[model samples]
Target: MGVTLTDSAAKHVANFLQKRGKGIGLRLGVRTSGCSGMAYKLEFVDEVNEDDLIFETSGVKVVVDAKSLPYLEGMELDFAREGLNEGFKFNNPNVKDQCGCGESFNV
Candidate 1:
C-alpha cells in the first residue's frame, strides 16, 4: 500500500500548485512531536530527492521519503469543509491511537 489523495484533496493541491506556478508535487511525511508522539507534515515540493518515493493519484503526485513510508503507507488524505473551517484530514489505517485534539497519532 502507498499514500493517496482523495479527489477533493488532489484538486486542492493541484490548484495551489498552479497558483504557486512551481511545484513537482506534495510531500507527505511524519515528524516526532505532539502528545501522541507523531504528527503529519505536508508541503509543496519544488524538488524531489533521489531517494524519494512517489505515488500518483487523481493527477497529483504524493511524494514520500523512504523513512516516512512505513508510517504513511496506505494513508488517504482528504480535504473537507465544515462550516467556515476547512483543512486536510488523514485517514491512516495503521494508526492505533490519536490525541484528543486529533492532530497527532500513534501506531
Candidate 2:
C-alpha cells in the first residue's frame, strides 16, 4: 500500500495550502539523518515531478518519491494537538526502531 493521510492531517494540510495560496499537494520523503539513521521529511508541493507517486485521502494528496516508497509504504499521516503541542505524526509500519527523542527511525 502507499502512504495515506488521516482526516485531521488532510484538513490541516489543506488549510495550510489554502493559506499559502499555491500548492498541488504535500510531499513525503526520507532523509539520512538523526540518531536512528533515517528521518521523515515533509514539504508542500507546488509542482509534481515526473517520477513522483501520489496518493489521495480525504481530498488531499500525499506525494512520495520512488526512493522513499519502501520505507514509507503503509504509513499513516496523523495530526494531533496534545496540550500546546501540535504536529504531524507518522505511523509507519515499516519502522522497526526509533530514537529516544522521537526525531528519527530505522527499518
Candidate 3:
C-alpha cells in the first residue's frame, strides 16, 4: 500500500507550492512526541532523498521517508474547512487511538 491525497489535499498543496515557487513536493512523517506518543509532521521538500518513497495523486507528489513508510501506508490526507477553522487532516488506518486533545495518536 501507498500514501494518498484527497483531491482537496492535492489542490491545497499544489497551491502552496505554486505560491512559494521552490518546493518539489510535500513530505510526511511521524515523530515521537505528543500526549498520544506520536504526531504527524509535514514539510515542503526541495529535493528527494535516496530512501524516500514518492506517491503521486492528482498531480501532487507526496513523499515519505523509508522509516515512516510502514506506519503511513494506506493513509489518505485531506484538507478541510470547518466554519472558522481549516487545516489538513490525516486519515491513518494504522492508528489505534488518538489523544483527547487531537494532536497525536498511538498505533
Scored by lDDT, the top model is 2
lDDT of each: 0.95, 0.96, 0.95
Query: What stretches of model 3 exceed 4 Å from their correct place?
Result: none
- Write down the RMSD of all candidates, one decimal each: 0.6, 0.5, 0.6
All candidates in order of TM-score, best leading: 2, 1, 3
Over 4 Å off, model 2: none
On residues 28-96, what C-alpha lDDT tens digit does candidate 3 reach at each position?
999998988999999999999999999999999999999998889999999999999999999999999
Instruction: Provide the lowest-lDDT 10-residue window in model 1.
Output: 66-75
List TM-scores for all candidates, in order. 0.98, 0.98, 0.97
**Across residues 1-107, which tens digit of lDDT does each residue of candidate 1 receive?**
79999999999999999999999999999999999999999999999999899999998999999999999988999999999999999999999999999999998
Over 1-107, each residue of candidate 2 has an lDDT whose tens digit, in order, gives 89999999999999999999999999999999999999999999999989899999999998999999999999999999999999999999999999999999999
Q: Give RMSD (Å) of candidate 3 vs. truth.
A: 0.6
Predict model 1's lDDT versus the native.
Answer: 0.95
The ten-residue window of minimal lDDT in model 2 covers 46-55
Output the lDDT of residue 68, model 1: 91
